[model samples]
Target: MKASRWARAAALLVLVGFTASCGLPRVGPNKREIYSGSVQREGDAFIVSVNDRVTRATAVVPALGFSAAFRNAGIVGSDTIRPGDTLGLTIYENVDDGLLAGQGLNATMLEEVQVDGAGFIFVPYAGRIRAAGNTPEAIRRLITERLADQTPDPQVMVRRVAGDGATVTVTGAVTQQGVFAIERPTRTLSAMLARAGGVAVEPETARVKVIRNGHTGEVWFEELFEDPQADIALRGGDRVLVEADTRSFTALGATGNQTRVRFETQTISAIEAIAQVGGLSPTTGDPTGVFIFRNEPEEIAKQVLGRTDLIGAQRLVYVLDLTEPNGLFLARDFVIRDGDTVYVTEAPFAQWSKALSAVSGTLGLASSLASIADNLNNN
Candidate 1:
């Protein structure tokens, strides 16, 4: 009986050792396993060490902007007339009962004179006159000259009212959505947004998109105000839209929170990203094995790896060792791009702890069974 008891104890010890060596369940692969599955070991992914040089090379911030054709375009004149515009004209005759007025009146008031699609307006004696592309003063001069031959020393005044010309359509995340005129104070992108009662969303995450002549240009709402060049001039028939940012990154493995986290600011560093997810798991997280998985474009991949042989987008795993002296600084400088996966591997000892706990529970159950057998035998 003593030999059997010793044999059972030895078997339990062997069983515990086998279970531990065979690998217990883990949250994720450890540092050594991750490294073994790298491109150097015929894996599909390339493993890169995040250092000062890599941080600088891969510190890319995504920016939205207009093309040269959109940015270089000149500002539209506020007073210029165009088709679908309303003009208010007042014509004064030097003498009563002249060509434009009766005996009691000296002026003829013409309100709501709409310019035709052909860019011409018809007056009594002026006939068909080109009104589009001319300012109110220019049109006043032309009408005066035309009526001078009919009425002696005729004086004319042309006023521009609410018109479709030089107007932009403002929509999306704004306080109000409507077609706004590109007036003197609201001719640029920033002014137009202000005229629409400002953006309704957070300024840091707001995105402004302008579509002109079937071409689209986009810029951040904050950037549109900060960068003067980004506040391009608005044109007639331009559609302006304001929206919120949609960029996000996934947090997995031994992180404090495993989920998809949206960007809270216009730009964020890796350290900020980890903090946004409640930081790493204090108990199970491996501080030396913080990894960032990203699919980088070919150009960026070349810059990051210093090699041009790779084509198209390449999968890259960047390792960050927070144990290093400058690791926090390095993380602070490393930009977290859209659609990145931040994974924190579990510490090596965490798996060992789990295995030891399992073994201890098994030994307790065996001891309980042995006590039951001895009690039955004594009975």
Candidate 2:
């Protein structure tokens, strides 16, 4: 009976050992598995070791800007007239009974003279005059010349009042969103944003976009204050939009948290990204197998790998060994882009510990069964 018990115990030990050698349940792939999935090893991903060279080569800062046409555009005249504008005209004639005024009056007041869609405004005897594309002073001169031909020494004074001409539409993430007239105080992009009650989102992450004549342009909100060149001039019929930044990276594997984390600032480093996710998991994280997965653009891939033959975006796996001498510095300098994945592999000893615990539990159950059989036989 003792010999049978020993044989069964040995068989159970072999079964547990076989199971442990085959595999154990894990949260993610190990370091060896990740390395085996490299392109050099016939895998679909390219693996690059993170170092000073890689950090320098991949240090890309994402920025928004306008095209040359938008940036180099001259500021528009605020007093320029356009269609749909309201002109307030005051006409004074030398004769007591003028064509525009009454028999006893010498001045004729025209209120709310709306410019038509064809950029023309009609007067009592001045006929139809082109008002759009001309300033108030130019329109006054044109009206005076037309009335001089009918009346004696007619003097015309044209002033622009509240109108819809040369206006910009401001919307999204602002204190007030509406169509605003382009006055002298709000002629440029920055001035217009201020007149619209400023940006409602955080300035660090605010993005401003402008669409004019189907050509679109974008810029960082902070850049408008920091760089004068970024504050492009606004045009008539311009649509301005302000919004928050949407850049983020996914944190997975043996980290403190597993989720998509947003960028808290304009630019973030790898160390900052790891800290954002609550750092690595002390129990299961392998300090030498921190990997960053990203799809590098063709031009960036060429610069990073020093190879020019690469086409399109390439899948890249950047390995960071925190155990190295300068690993922390490299991580601190490496830039984390918008749609990246930060993964930390499990330690080798962690898997071994799991397998040992499983084997010990199975052996303890076998011992309990043997003791039960011995007690029954004695009875």
Candidate 3:
């Protein structure tokens, strides 16, 4: 009985040490710069920002009245076609009844046309067709005239065999990967993604960028998701890349989960931010260390705390304490801006438990190994 009790006690001691190691307080040492501030809490909820700064303008305006920004931003132009672009065409005078023979298009090589990388498609009987700068109607008329000499009543139908031009590239978190061909006008970015088997990972933020004519343009993905007017249409030969969320906000220090969240809008609330992080850990989290680091000094915390000494009127640190129950109400109302960080500190006991647990695990593991070795030797 005594030996069994001793063995059990030893095992418990080892486990206690292991538990302590896992309990250590985590204070991330790196001081990352961020933009954080307090926003007044109101019962009403509203959208953060309506205007997008990066996507609103383009670089140049063509004679066609399309803005320069539209071109620089990759929003317009035939050379700027992306995957899932639709090209429509109506043939003019040359209708080919002989080739059809009351059935369909003849199996002759003359019916085949090759689309090139430069946004040009070649019709066998028509020779080199200039499609880069021309609209679908223009391409059809050009084809109709070229075949007028050889075949009477030559009717030409023009549409994209795949994409507006030739190929489209998908970058970032997609599954099947790389640039691919668009074979039909009914294809879409969403459809292509579905064909590609969808995105590899579901990020906190989701967005798609359209690159064309060597320019980067952003699609209003949220608008596209909501079927709004702000959503831009895609073109052939355009590269569509769906990447992980570009913006992220980090929550460090004392929280249930120290994780980063994607930023969708310009403004977020402290309560919302806390909710994203899974809230406070019951045993270790301290209400006092809840802070939003900014360019300002510690004195910033004083205003939030309604106290004057701790923040010291310095211009470097901004801290906020949620010790008071009313602080929760204030925090719920406070607005957290983009690129903000929310941190909470662990209690002293929690920190000590973590440190002791670490030391205990190392010692316990060593002791367990030593006991096993002794038993083996005895056997």
Point to the candidate with the largest TM-score.
1
Q: Cα deviation of 9 in candidate 3 (Å)?
A: 29
Q: Quote the lDDT for 329 in model 3.
A: 62
Question: Could you tell me how far off, in angstroms, the CA of residue 200 lies in candidate 3 after the best superposition?
Answer: 5.5
Model 3's alpha-carbon lDDT is 0.54
> To one decimal, what is the Cα RMSD in angstroms of model 1 from the true structure?
5.2
Stronger candidate by lDDT (2 vs 3):
2
| Count of backbone collisions in candidate 3 | 32
> What TM-score would each prediction reach against the true structure?
0.79, 0.78, 0.47
Which candidate number would show the highest lDDT if scored against the true structure? Answer: 2
Model 2, 195-275: lDDT tens digits are 989999999999999999999999999999998989998887899999899999999888899999988899999889989
> Candidates 1 and 3: which is better by TM-score?
1
TM-score of 2: 0.78
**lDDT per residue (tens digit) for residues 178-260 in model 1:** 98767778889999899999999999999999999999999999888688889898888899999889999999888889999
* Regions of candidate 2 where Cα sits further than 4 Å from its true position: 1-23, 86-113, 122-164, 363-379
Pairs that collide, model 2:
none
* RMSD in order of candidates: 5.2, 5.8, 13.1
Alpha-carbon lDDT, every model: 0.88, 0.89, 0.54
Return the lDDT, model 3, position 211. Answer: 70
Each candidate structure's count of clashing pairs: 0, 0, 32
